[model samples]
Each structure stands twice: as C-alpha cells, then as structure tokens.
Target: MTLQNQSGTSTIRPTIDTMDLEEIVELRTSHMVVGGAALARDANGRVVFVSGALPDELVMVRMVTAKKDFATAEVVSVTEPSASRVEPACEAWHRGCGGCDWQHIAPAAQVAMKTDMVREALSRTARVDQPVVVTGAAIAPWGYRTTVRLAVGDDGRVGFRSRRSHDVVALRACPVADERINGLLATVVAAGTDELSLRVGVAGAELIAWGAPGALVSGLADTVRIGATAVVHEDVAGHRFRVSATSFFQSSPEAAELLVAAVTRAAAGLDLGQCTVIDAYGGVGLFAATVARGAERVVLVEASASACADARHNLRGQRAEVMEMRLEAWTPIAADLVIADPARNGLDKSAAARLVQTGASRIVLVSCDAGSLARDTRLLREHGYAHRGTEVLDVFPNTSHVETVTRFDRFAPGDRANHPDHV
Candidate 1:
C-alpha cells in the first residue's frame, strides 16, 4: 500500500504476512502515549502499545490483543534499555499499583515525555498549530504530592487500586506522596476503615477516614475527621488557602504555585484596576485569593458548598465575592479576566457558551483533561477567541495526569465581524 509520509511524499508501506498472532517479538518503543504507555510499530507496520516500557527502548513484548491497525502488548523483557530507564522506587509498582506508572522512567525523562504528551494532545485534539511550552516539569518531581487517597479492604488494610483492576495493592509507603503522608502510612495498619485520605500542607497532615465513624485512634495527622470532611491549610506562592478533604487541590504544592504563576503571567499585560476577575469552578478560592490582590473585584463561583465556605474564609481580607453556583448556572458577570479550573469532565456546552458570550478581555483556562481542554478551545475559537498560548505543568508526577493552563484573547472587531455567528 502507498501512504503519504510526514514530508507529504507517497511511500510504499509494508505489511507483516508471516507474523504469528500473540507471538513475542522485539520492538522499539519510540514515544510515550498520553496514558503512560510506550508506543511502537511492528514489522507489519501495526501500532503496538506496550506498558512498562520507556521510549527508545528495544523490548520483547507479548501481544495481548491484536486488531487490524493496532495491538496492545505487555513487556516481557527489555533487550535494550533506554538511558532514562531506572529502577522504580516503590516495591508495589510491579504488583500493579496504578499510582505511579512512570516510576520506572528517570525523572527528567518523565518530564520531557509529559510535555510532549500535552503538545501532542493539543495538536491532535484542538487542531492547535502553535508549539506548546510546558513549565514546572523538573521542579522536584518526586515527593511532591501533598494529598493522596488510600483504599481499604474489608479486613481494614489500607492500599491503592491495581492498574485497571479493582484489586488492592498493599503499600507500606508511597514515595511520590509527601514525606508526612509516608510517615502517617507507616503508622496506620488495620485502621478498620473502608477508605483513607491523607493530606499534608502548611497545617500539617490531616486524615479523613471514610468508613466506620469513630474517634481518632492514633496521632497520625495534625487533625483527623471521621468522614470525608476535614480542613487543611495549604501555602502556595507565599499565600495561604484553606482546602477541605473533599475539595479539589493540586497534589503538588510547588507545581500548584507554578500554575498560579503561569496564570498571573498570562494576565500581566492586561490592566485589572477597577475591573472584575471571575474565577469559575474556583475550589477553595485558590485562584481567587491569588488574583484578588491585583483586581479591584475578584468573584469566585463554585458549585460545592464546602469549597465555597472555605473560599469565604480564604478570601476574607481581599475584595472577593464567593458565589456558590455552578459555572453553567452562574449569571455572566462583567469582567476583564475569567479563569476557570474545571474538573476532568471540563467545561460542558453551557459553560463553553457562557465563556464565549461573557465578553471578557482575557480568559485563562486550567484543565487537567486534554480532550476536554481541546474541545473547549475549539469552541472558543469558533466564537472568535484567538489562541494566545499554553503552558503545561507536571502536577502529578510518575502518572499520566498533567495540568495545562491555556490563555485566550478575544479577536479584533474586524475578525469577529467576519465570523458567521457574530452579532
């Protein structure tokens, strides 16, 4: 068969005719996928997705599932290991703990691949042609997670879920988690709970037991709550913010500060005096508190009551208003800048429409899901929003999750006049 290559030249492609199905073959992993798998192409030119393999490594892989265009495989042996390959710090990694998929990869390599992954996602999903610049990749990738949730079996064993399976992988310590969590995990055995969440920050470690409400049995954390609600204070970029056990917060405090800095940098050229800045889906007012100091009015709109309460406390001294409403339901307010940090589901149709219709001068979006971010970006472009730039942050190290902050500015009046839906 003939196909157009990257250079736009028609080239003859070869297919594997003699290759046996499910046979073990040596393959070279050329790149890392968004989901933490290494990608390779077989002699037949079929794409192979291999787990536990690093880029530029030649490994023996046994095909688990095969189709006409692609196959999924498991690494049987690494015949040639990449320079970035390293021994995983966690013993539970081999047993299928899904928390740290890139643990076997060197820290620097992991950051490089993560940045590439974000760029690829934007180009493929959002049709963005500009190059993506990712920051905060090498800033203490390990021991950075300030919060982690552990599952509990019926027998009161605390651990994490296996990769793509419900099975629990017992863990004595998680190296990526904050040192405080590791210390707490070391002490907690047979806590007789169904689930445990550990968070450590400026306030110290806090534990929230999910099952069997009872009094604190140990001095594992600074504060302990029986259920899923506990107050945790976090210090980011020299600012203090209140975070709840159930509220969403960045796993890495240093990375969170980097993300905030990215947002502030995106807004540096814009004037904010006597103007309003809306922080949509603002969990615990992290963005609102940081940006409130510069704007005359900082409006925080959130859906969770617990988070809104925390925001009220966190933004007390600033000129901020905490609105407990979903992004879609909140009335569009006049603002100079709007920053939305939605969940993995991203901005829905209603929220996207509001963003385009809000008439904000600048919009900064912080998204964790690439597909959702791309979809929203496309929607904004359709409504005459020009793509400014994007910065990717490695918030969750050794895993597939990466935090991306994208900036957009409304197009000029002439450009908007040519838009099909322009009013």
Candidate 2:
C-alpha cells in the first residue's frame, strides 16, 4: 500500500500479513478521545482504540479499517472489566443508541474527560495557553433531557439512530430524557400507526407535543407565561424564560444559567451600557434579555421566524430590537459588544469574516462544540482579536456534549507588539 501527502509526495506503507492483522488484542480504555476510546497498539504492531470498554479494562478488538498509516477497529469482547465501569442508567443508552455516548463511563470521569478534551483542542488546535475552567453538570445526569426527536420505523417502532449510522435503533426508554417524556414513549409507539417520525419534548414523561405552530401538553398549568409563550417554571436569578415545548431552549436549565452568567460577566467589563449590542443566533432571546438590562440598545438576530416571533413576544416590553435574519445574511452594524450563541456548527466563515471586519471591541461567544469553537476562535484571533478567557459549562450531563463561553478582545498596539507572529 502507498499514501500520498498533500504535496503529492508518495510513500510506501508497511505490509502486514492477514495472520498478523487478524489477531485480537486486549486494550484498556483510557480518557475519552475525540469520538471515543483512547488506545495504543501493543508489541504485535496492531492499532487499538478503546470502545465500550472502560478505563483499566481489557477488551478484544478486530481491525476493520486499516489505512496506509493508521487503523480503526471494532470491539469483539471485554475480557476484563474496569473498576469504574458501571451499569448504564438508561436502557436505551446501553442498547447501542447513539443519543448518549458516555453512559457506560463513570460520571466523574465523563466530566474530567470532557474538560480535558476542550483544553487539548484549544491548546493543540487554537494554540492558546489560557486555562480552561470547567463546571460540572448542573443537574442529575439522568432524566434531564427535555427535548428528543425520534425516528419511527416502518415496523411501528420509535427509536434513535444507530452508532455512527443512519440505521434506527429501537428503544424502550431513554434514561437521560425527562421522566415525563420517557413515559410517553409507550404512548407514542402505540400512537404511531401511520406517522413516520415523531419529535416530543418531555418535562417529567408528559408529552409536550409540538407541531409546526407549536402546542403545549395539557396538564402543565403552573407554567409561567411570558407573553404568549409558556414553559415549565425554572427560574434563574429571578428571571423566568418562557420556554415552549418545541422552542429552542437549552435542555439543561442549570447549565444554561451558568453559561448566561459567564457571558454576562465576560461582557461586564465592556462599556455595553452606552453601546449597541448584537445578539446573533439568539434563541428565545434568553441571553439577549439577560444582558439587555445594561445595554443602551440590543439587537436580537435569529434565523427562525417562529423563534423570532416568540422572542419578540417574550421581549415585548423590554428595550430591544428584534431582527429575523440569518447571521450570514444580516449586515453588521456598528456595535461595541457582539454576543453570539450560534448553533452546534458555530459561526460560518463568512459570518466570522464579517465579524472581524466589524472589529467589535468585545466578543462573547457561546458554543457547544469545542472543535468548532476553537476553529472560530482562531479565525477571529487571526482577524485582530485576542483571547481573554474561556469557561466550560456542562450542559449535557452523562454525554460528550459541553458548552463554553469564550471572551475575546480586539488587538491593541502593546498587546500583539511582542507577538508579531500572531498576526
């Protein structure tokens, strides 16, 4: 076999006989790597990666995909169990549903691994030396997910997608889902006689059914109503955000509160009191309203028309400007502070370019994917922004998902003078 580098230089790859490649090796699971598993080959010259295996556990695996230099494998069996390995709390999670990736791993290890992953990505990818602070999960790891979208199979089964595949994995119950939502799985399965897909939000297994226009589950009455919007009562610092069943609200309210606090604190040093603030990709304007108390003017930008309408209604009496436009299409107006809470993909290149061109003095970015966040951070830093600090909030507990609030400041003469290479 041979491999070609980016420059078109070709190099011959090492040869391994079928016998040597077929051998199974027992490997211990270390920290969770990018996708999963952290393993190295042994003296037999075979590549290994820990899968469902836990730390200090010996697992046998067979190489399935071997490139010229590296290889991928599938777990064959676990010969030894790790001390930290615990029975997964979710029945659906243990049955190969990709919804919860780190269910088998211990909860404490999950948080530590996630934090390390962020720090490693920033240091290796973004080349930042600043310490990344990580806050543990805000609520119980189980039964905290308020929203879930499940695909219904033709055989009258509702389930999640298989691990790294489009195939649907039948599920009975999801432990991470709110009890209200999980309880409805049976009803949903029984109700899906002709429907091909179902997306339900759970607060406790009570179905918070949402359609194109959105609807509320019947029994939840004490729910606070912000304008026309209504959601289960969950207060943060005395502020109640009316989160509809289907509206885009953070699943982990505790984590979201911390994230909001971090963003507010990061922007507190800036002079937002007299400057225009742009909240791009603003969901229900949670952060927008939270930070608007101090800003002279706040522009809430959202691509979802329904979300925009909901935000408008939510901010009915507040002093804010609502714009229903995509971040990529919206023209950047002059502003002192720019706070963006984009989707999992983070900001697109064009949007990032426009932000750099706008040269906002202070940028507060809230991201769920660290890899994308690091990439965007590097892009901004290249366009004359300097990293101030970053804080990680555990939004999705018992899973690989995490949210971060990163603060960046415009470059000054003395700031990058010594580090000219930063430019």
Candidate 3:
C-alpha cells in the first residue's frame, strides 16, 4: 500500500500478509537516535533503524523485523563512512555489546549530538526555545566510569548484555569503565556467579558477587563480598558517600562534581544562611551534602533504605536531616528551595503537584532523561513555575543519555519568613 511519511514523502509499503519477511535492504543512515540506533529511510520511505552504522554512511542491512511503518535491521557492512566516524575503541563494539553505543563516533561529535538532542527536546517537548548551555566534553572519556555491572552468561562469560536483547557479550575489558574496575574482571569471572558489580573510588575497589556464595569473596579489592550487597566508599568534593550495590551514584567522579557545581550555581541567591532546602529523591545525599554547607537546614528525601543510611552517614556532622520515605509520602515542608534529582522516570505526578504545594520559591531539577525532564518541566509550568534556564552536562560520554539541570521560579510570591512548621 502507498503511504505518506512524516517528512511529506510518498512511498510504497509492503503489507505483512504479502511482504517477504527475509528480505535484505540497503540503508543510507541519516542520523543517530537514542540508544545508539542509526535511523535511515527505506526505499518505500519507511524508517529503518540499524546499529553499528554512522550518519551519512551507506550500509548493507539485514532486516530483522518489519512493522507497519518502520523496520529494524543489523548492519552487515558499511559501504561508506562519515568523517566523524572512527574505529570503535572496544573490539566488542560490533558484537552487540550494549555498554557504549557511540564509541564509534568521535568524542567531540558525541558531545555535540547530545547537546543538540537536549536542546531539541526542550524546544519541541518543553516549549523552551532558549539555547541549552552545555558543559565541555570529558577530559578523559575512556577509563572514566567508576562503576559497572557485568552480566555472566551460562557458559561463564562475564560481560554486558546485548542491545535490546538478552544475549551477553563476553569482554576482557570495557574501554569506558575505570581501569580499576577492569582490573577486577578476572576476580569477577572467578566468583562463578550470574552477575557481579565492581565499584572503584579513592578508598579502593569493591566487588559484589550476585547469587554467589560468600566463600567466593577474596582479596580482589580492598572490600569484597557476596550476595549482591556491599557498600563502597566514594569521596567527592571532600565528602564521603557509602554507595551500595543497588544505590545510585554518578559513574564519573569528575562529571559528578560538575553536576554538583551546576546544582550549587543554580541554587544560588537564596538566603542559605537561614533558608531551608529540600533535596527530593536525594540518593546518598550528593546534593544535600554539597549544599549543606550553606543551607541552615537541609532535608533529604529518599526512598531507598540503603541510600538513606548512606546519606545519614554522609551528612553526620552536617545540618542536613534525612527522611527515609518517598517524595509522595513525605510531608511537605515550607522551604526556600527544593532540588530534585529523580531517576529516569522523573518525578511522580502526585509528588510533583505536592512539590508545588510546598510553596518553595525556587526549584532545581536535575534529570538524566530529556523526555522526562521536558514532561516534568511542563508539569511545573502548569503549576505556575517559570523555567529560568537549563545547563546540560555530558556526564555519560559515548552514550545517548544526557544530564540536565533546570531551575524554575514560582510566579506567585510566597512568604520567605520562617514558618513554625517548616523543617
């Protein structure tokens, strides 16, 4: 049947009832998408997504699946290459190793693409036309990831999962992972477990073996344990954070500091000496601890017990208070500012409404997903908050994930004086 695409192009599409399911097609890639797929238009004007190909390149693709308007393919060969394309740093790049998708793209080009993606998301989704301010690319893109979880296959191969598949690709080392983490791969393989995690910091490396007996633990790192649980200490900005296997911590120490600095800059101009601040979804109190020096009273709201405990430990001598509850369950306290760094899902809808109810004059939202950031930005806009500005940080280099810090100011003036019920 003939169809018109979003780009105002007319073409023919084969029906599922009559189309040759095993047909191969040639695709000239146009651009990259989230999750590292190179998007191209097929002969019939239908979208085709293929991996291991760069934009402005001609690739022979083996169609794996076909849908009504689009198809998914795997690159069989690259007939042409882009100037920004480079040989993948990892030998496992084309082997379906899903760890680093943009490893084939130049580091500078990757950062530029991420910046454009964030800016486009804000412009198209959040209705913000302002140019996004992006931080410079990482000085050391390779060997910067402080933590990584390696999946173990049934055959005892330790590596990462395949892109959009359950298949595990074995690896000797990951270029994006820290050298210390790569150094423990041998120990992880010896643990004889289904999965394992390695975390490295100033204190040293810690290994967490999943579904393995505690007896498997040895001198792989300074601290090693089994049962998929253990806390690793990370020193950031003069503060120490005890991060567990499940707790969230920035993978790159340098980028984490940059994020904290962005948060601090966005939260400036408040009466920090006497004003109260809330760190919503404050995993391990990264923001709370960093901003606590200026905040007279800081309340950290986290749902993870382990993360809350870590926050409590991290903020022991500071003036911050830890609340071990979800943002939706925690009672709203009047404050001068609220800083939320939620997961990829962004803020809960109910809790976002409640955040508006808190009547904080300033709110800083730090997010990893641009789509969620845009969604939550619109939610706050509907509640009478003005989007001041945003700064994008290239924390996760060589990947589509982008981190953004957006500040919003409430339009309706609220009382800045201390309230008796305010924490």
Candidate 4:
C-alpha cells in the first residue's frame, strides 16, 4: 500500500567505491519482482533491481547499493517505456512523495502485477502449482484511504517521507486520501510534534496528537478532535468496531468489508456455530466479533495490550476470551478452527509450529506479504496440513500490496489430535 511496499535497508552500509557508484548502466527489465522492483541483469550478468520502471522497459539505472550477491539501482531515465506506464495522478508523487510505488503504472496493470507476484511467490517458494487470482476493488482507486500518517519537517511543514530517505516531502494534498482527509491538510496543526495521524471514524474526523492543541489548531479546534481519543468506532458490514489508536485495522471501511467477506468465504463449510474458533494474532477482534461470532467459544491472542483491551470491548458479552500474548509464546488449546494474521515476516518456524500444535482442523490465514505467505504455506504443508485454496483482494488499489486469505485443512489420517473432543 506501496503499504503504506517501502524498501528498508537493515544491512550496514559498505564503504563506497567512486567508480561503481558513478557508472550508469542500461538494461531491459524482464518482470516485476517481490519488492515492487523490476528485475534485470547488467552487462556483467549481475542481477539488478531497478525501481521506478516497468517490465519490458529499457531504463538507464545508476547503482545505489552494492552487495556481493546483488545490487539495487535507481532509474535515471526510461529509454523505452511500457505501454502500461502512466503519469502519476498526484503532485505529491511528482514531488517525490514515497507514499506509493506503483503510481507510475496503470491501475489494471497494477492488479495484474500483484497477481503474477502472488503466483510466482507460491510457485517458487511454496512449490504450489495452483492458479492465483486477485480481485480488484469496485470503488474508485483514489480517495479511498481513511487513515494517513504524516511526518513533520524542521520547518513545521507536514507530509510524507521521501523515497529511500528520511527527508520529508511537504504536501498540499494527497490524491489517495479520502477527500475529507485532504481537506484537513491546510488546517492540520503540526506544532509541538514531529508526527501526526489523521483518521475518519464513525464519530467523524479525528486528528491525533500527543499534547494540547495550540493556536495553530485552534482554528478548527471545535470541528476536529485534536487530542488523545481513546478509541474510534468504524462501521463495517453492519457492525461497529471499536478501534484504538494503535490497533491494526484495514486502510478503509470498504477494504475491511471486502476482507471480511473474503475471510468468511474462505471459512465456508466450517459451520462456525458449533466450532471453537481461535483468532490468532487477532487485533481488536475483527474476525471474532464478525465472522466467528456464532462459534461455540472464541479465544483471541494478541501481543498489544491496547488491542487486547479494544478486543475485549469489541467482543463484550460474546463467548469470546482475549489473551494478551505473542502468537509464538501462547500455549495452544485444542480448537476446531483458527484464523491467523501474522506480520509481514509471516510466522516464524516456532510460531507456525505452535499454530499447528493447536490442532485446529480448519485454519484461515491472512497475509500481506507474498514471500512470507509462500514460506508459511510450505511450513504448514510440512505439518500435515493441506493447502485448500487462497483468495487475494486488491484492497489497497494503486499500490503493490494485495491481501491474501488462504485456507488450510489438517488431513492427518488416523490422528485423533487433529479432531478435537468438541468435534
């Protein structure tokens, strides 16, 4: 959601050699890779990942990073551009706002690229030969975001950070943000803080800042809530969810509804009414409060205390229990069903093994990263769980991110543990 595919470098910087950094190389990209970059090879047959370019396009690139295994480069110019290339719709993008990565690509092409990315990840990493399809959103791509975080500069100007740097790119408007959010840009007060958060909740527009509002914000102080608001309510699929400031929620209500329908569809035939559902890595009990509501009993495990509190409130009076703990650290209780939504790195070996230990026959997994999804799929397969199917949705349009909902069924023959006593 270009999420919000950002490239970060954790590796230590190597002492630069002037010759390599100064050399400009031209290469034709073969295809898009996992991290929203185009794959190509230089004259020396070295793998080169080119940013800001598309497949089958010849671009002149300059090396920005040099590693023994591979290198990353920035596009100096596109010698031959793909037909899918389009002028980015936002002035912020042209001003070097790193909010999106696929802004230069056509919308339809963006979906196609994300689909191919999922298929390739599964095939290369999970060893699955199944067809992958990603459904595009029905609503217009622009003005869908209900949440936006801005970085404040030394000059008190607020906007998004630049691409591949910590510098800020001041903005007057953001194209992808909801129209209401864009309206707050002029009135937003960035005083006394380096970061600001804006959101559209059921109560209305909210501006989250740590301290008291100054005269800069006094202009709209009566209109917008510009203080520490405990929880914001959002209506999704006929349900209102109490979301904390730090809770993980979908970018917009529409995206949340789309994801909810996808998860419910993936869990079909489970007859959740009579089953014990475990919402692993649950944040604010989104799945538990909605799709898993009718389950006989529900247990939600989360790492964030704030989310746990919100989950308890969101799932109040229901047969739901909120456990504040990390997924890998939680002790498993035998259940009939499970829903796991781990972070981008996916479940580590220990975490995946713990999930398998739950002995839940029906499991639904939500993944935001393709590589992690493929790896976790392989790990689950090794634990006697068969990959039933996967559904992907482009909830975040105009970005390189896609939400994947996958189902797994434990099919260990003659294994009593796979079927809990409740079943």
Candidate with maximal lDDT = 4
lDDT of 1 by residue, 19-63 (tens): 455677667888877677889987667798999898888897777
RMSD in angstroms, candidate 2? Answer: 6.7
lDDT of 3 by residue, 340-413 (tens): 99889898679898788888998999988878887888888778777777787778888778888888888753
For each candidate in the order shown, give its overall lDDT on alpha carbons: 0.76, 0.66, 0.75, 0.78
Please report the TM-score between candidate 1 and the true structure: 0.86
User: Clash number for every model?
Assistant: 0, 6, 0, 2
Error of 2 at 342 (Å): 1.6
Candidate numbers sorted by TM-score from highest down: 4, 1, 3, 2
lDDT by residue (tens digit), candidate 4, 200-259: 674444444333333133334455666545457888777778877667778888888887
Residue-wise C-alpha lDDT for candidate 2, range 310-383, written one tens digit per residue: 68866777779888988888888888888988888888788887666666788899988878888887888777
Identify the runs in model 2 with alpha carbons over 4 angstroms from their true place: 1-23, 28-30, 39-49, 53-58, 78-83, 135-137, 164-167, 190-207, 211-236, 244-246, 417-423
Model 3 stretches astray by more than 4 angstroms: 1-22, 130-139, 190-193, 204-229, 413-423
Q: Give the Cα error of residue 205 in candidate 4, in Å.
A: 5.5
Overall local distance difference test of candidate 1:
0.76
Candidates 3 and 4, the one with greater lDDT: 4
TM-score each candidate: 0.86, 0.80, 0.85, 0.87
Best by TM-score: 4
The predictions' CA RMSDs to the true structure, in order, are: 5.1, 6.7, 5.6, 7.3
lDDT of 1 at 96: 84
